[model samples]
Target: MGNCIICGQDVDGRICQSHEEDVVFDFRGDSPDQLVRNRFYRGVVDGYADFGVFIDLSPNVTGLLHRSEIDGRLESLDWEAGDTVYVQVKSVRENGNVDLTSSIRQSEGEFRGTLIQERTEEKLPEEVEEGNGSERSDEGNGRERGTAESDGGGGAVETGVTTEAETETEEEPEPEPVETVSEPETAAPTAEPESEAESEPEPEAEAGAEPAAETETAAEPEPREATHSEIADLPDRVDELVRIEGEVVSARQTGGPTVFELRDETGVADCAAFVEAGVRAYPEIEIGDIVRLDGEVELRHDEIQVETEALVELEGDEAAEVERRLADAMTDRARPDELTLVAHDERLEAISGNLLDAAESIRRAVLESRPIVVRHGATADGYVAGVALERAILPLVREEHATSDAEYHYVNRRPLEDAVYGMNDATNDVTKMLQDRERHDEKLPLVVLAGTASTVESEDGLEMLGIYGADRIIVDAAPADPEIAAVTDVLVNPESDDALSTGALASSLATTLNSGVGDEIAHLPAVSYWEDTPQSYLDAARDAGFDEEHVTELREAVALEAYYQSYSEKRELIGDLLFGESEEAVAAAGAPEDVAAEESLAGHIATQFREKLDTEVETAQANTEESEAAGVSVAVLDTDSYTHKYDFPPTSLLLDELHRRSDAEVTIGIAMDKLWIRAETDLDLRAVALDAAENAPNAGISAAGLRECRIEFLSGAREEVEIAVIGAVTEQFD
Candidate 1:
């Protein structure tokens, strides 16, 4: 007996029965029968086959880690031959064959302790032969080696056979009870007629599936027409046999069965079919194929699933009718009835038609099981917009997909460093989506650029997505170039003459996507606005139980956090702040402690936000270079020289806060290579950049990001570019 290393409990082996899964063992035994079932063992990757990977527990005993046992595509595995890996022994067959399943603990370091599992009593065939005869039997070894090479089967192909010759001097029939039981079972037939020897390995080869195949054939039910039922109705008819006709949304292989996600006009459900353990059931049926499935309804872990008996791909008129029905149903269900604006505004009212179109595109993507990737600016307003959309779409994703974690699978929100979808961002997104398509048979995602990539600067990135037939949607509060409208599938830009925030627009779009959560998101639009919030939105926020003080705390907290990790979604933390509810409270059915925690967290972050912003603003105000151009107050601060670089509150965000505090008519923050402009009067940044470039040709001036009215110039000509920009600003005021 031994004590368990993890739990300190006494057990028969090094690890206790309850903690057996916690530790990975190194099998020191030579035979497959020595391996304890359901225990994790360290194995070496031998080779790869179409069906699975061959993992050798030792030199003689090998197991099949089938493709279905893999969590992802087989091609995605980085394991090479001879590489050390961990696998669980699911079962062992009578023919010395082993079956393996994927181990949750892949690394040896994850285990609390490691131990050697040795069986000292059982001996190898060669060791037994040595005791009986002084010399080994060459003919017996040759016949076994030849049989091993000739047999093309799934079970244990190599059992380390040795000679079974009874007499020491010459060739003879081997004695029984040679200790190595497998060798005689195989080598005994070799001593019979040549025909019998040839046929002997067939049964050994088919040993893995013999029992299952025989049971399946014998228990085959008589043909009968099953009652047709919709996938939505399967939840009510548990354990009942029924037939369903739908389109295959996705097909995934598990260690035991192939789970196919079938979607009909009503809903989606998982249909599991098993041909054998760790084998693909129906290889011909693929995503988007119309098929008829006969199965028994069963509820597993509160999720309705069908245990498939037979699945057949439909054709001709039957296929056409199902396809047409699905298309019509999706169209009716995906599109929203009307545009529901959180707050009434003339700018938003004018773009109601465009907002509805964009909302419909997002809704359709969810219903079709296509992933929705939202790329938004990494700012308070941008994060609010992204979170608003996430809040609305996640519930729908949960309802539409049969999987519990469908929200993470179907909806993704990626933050952009800048409000522009450049080649780098497009390339990363394209690579991931393409890999997901090839590996998992997922459809191309519908890419939504919120408060970013609506301008002409992102045309290249948009065109790249267009080339792959990925649908694009843009929602921006800024004035967008007219040329970009033609390229995108839907454009929701008001092009309003008044100042507006992207959060205001996107929050309304979120409501249009799912109106059931309208009350929860009513305050989001107000949180996006830093100053000069519309009266209607302010009133709406007040009605949603968020006063001005609480809203300010949320806004400041979101902005402060948004700057630290500008490229990550930070889903849970942001969700807690925006909804003012903790995960614990929600899990406990809306406890009041979460509300107090949310307020406390927001207040703490907001305090830090003020402390950080105040220091930067004080430093920036001290080093300001003030002047007057055509009676308009102008201030230029060398941001690189005055403020902290590569720290919290990035240069762009710092400039925005400073500009808001200043009483000047115009604020210009000039970095070494780029400059940001904010003006009280209507100023066209693109025209100003073009004129400045003409005035100082050597400066290499160009408006790189029109979303922020940001212009780029060569650092060598920083002085020249500054003078030319000031001159352009003077002309605009004059």
Candidate 2:
């Protein structure tokens, strides 16, 4: 026998049985039937189609990598028609068609095994020598063990590595074997898998077992009804019987237990259900299904886990009752623990229900395995809000999924300039979702508009999703148009309360969405505001241990990072700056290095923020054309001429700082195609546009914002249009 190239185990062929799928092969087989299913193969890029990429595996064999199989934005792929890529052979159609899937590992270095040389009839030199020896041996017994015959599901192949296969991997008992619970008196479910009880000795009956007094199990009367228990409170109730009804967010059959991730409104916990060795318990159970379960709390590996006894799917009215209770509990429990000094404030309370609704949609997306795409403005407030949701949702994702890359797969934050979700962004989402649907069979993601898309300018972009029938949620701290709120599936706007920053609203929402990450993001709301923060919010920040200095550093640091990558959300940097003080994260020697790293990074970025803002504001203020129009102070700047329009510290951020620095009640920035607005008081641009159209028939202007003062006007009417628009906007203050 020869040793397997991987793991150095004795094998009949080049690779071990388990690692057969790890190596990508250069397929020479002409017929589809000759190819092995579930094997990785090296293929050449043949061409691309709108639906998928065509790959040439061999002279007569080809496969398709559907666009849906890609992991990122398909448009960004730098692949050409002739490059090589690795793919997994999924299946071959009866009519000679081949289907392929994206390999999790793309490079040869990523694989842990070696390549096998496929040859026709003739065996390797070593095989020929062994055959000759067998024929010549006079005293040898002619006993033969044959290789595995296909059962058609990538069934076992003989690698001649019998040591581990016979002793461990193939015969090893599942981590925890299923057993029939011999509880004194309990009714059994209709179906149960085979049990290990008959073959194995019970843990309690094993030699060197603890004495009777050491056993935690006591013959006590069971409660008439199962006591409802919170997952977090399971530790205190160890050795006690309890029941929890929640959605089965995840389930996996292991050697020892069928672990189910049960999530209720309160929190998530794992419930281990076992029936027999290597047997799947509750064969009909699946993820995303609701179940009512009874289990005794147990401490395994210093973590709270449930020792499941009875598990049944809650159906009909029973299911409806459980879901209704869960929603009520979530609405109450998901709310931020304290609204800061602002929690009891009259204004925020007015729109609290809307916040809860938006939070519910986001949380539901997590439970349903739907992707969440957060589109936020590339400002400190937008980044803070976007990161707030990211912080809250990521932990839930890690808990719910077995895949290591689930966070990246299920949640994405895209930054938009102008704080608007434009058609360009909509097109990107549409292409991505369609591809995901085709490739991975993922459902269309729930697009959440936060910190942006609360105005008329974003309406067209948001409505674009209707072509695919995708739903959206909007949570804005800006003065939003009421119409935008009405159109969204879920909307939480500060206008219903009072003018608040999106960061503040998102922080509160984050607490309700996942309080587990709330403390890490508590300082975000205060960081969102440049100045004039509410007393209640400041008090909340203070309570969360954020001083004014730290808040300022975070605010400036986020602004700096946001400016650097205006289009891409700085997820990692923002998370570190905002949540560096996490107690859960520890480094070597336990120095709380994450906290230290965050402070250093924030301080450095804040320095850059102050210096950059100072320079940009100076340029904008110097170039500003301050004039009086119809008894209103109007500051008009030729933004295209005066500002670095295409670099970091985007035009919106520069204009915002300029408007704040200059004493301009109404500021109008004229560019080639669009007009930018910033004002001390809310101006009715819709009225101004109508007035301009009435006075100058050729002006051709349209209004498009709530708090933002942008409008669409003819580029040819630049000088004349600005004069008319400024005059019309100035008259509004009257």
Best prediction by lDDT: 1
Looking at candidate 2, the ten consecutive residues that score lowest on lDDT are: 136-145
Evaluate residue 683 in candidate 2 and report its C-alpha lDDT on the 0 to 100 scale.
68
Identify the candidate with maximal TM-score: 1
lDDT of 2 by residue, 84-166 (tens): 67898888877666788898777777876435234212123344544322221100001111223232368653312232234
Candidate 1 global lDDT: 0.77
Estimate TM-scores for all models: 0.74, 0.61
Q: Model 1: what TM-score?
A: 0.74
Of candidate 1, the 10-residue stretch with the lowest lDDT total is: 134-143
lDDT of 1 by residue, 446-535 (tens): 999999987788888889998998999998888778778877999998856588889999989999889987999999999999899898
Query: Relative to the unseen true structure, what is the C-alpha lDDT of residue 720 in candidate 1, on a scale of 0 to 100?
Result: 92
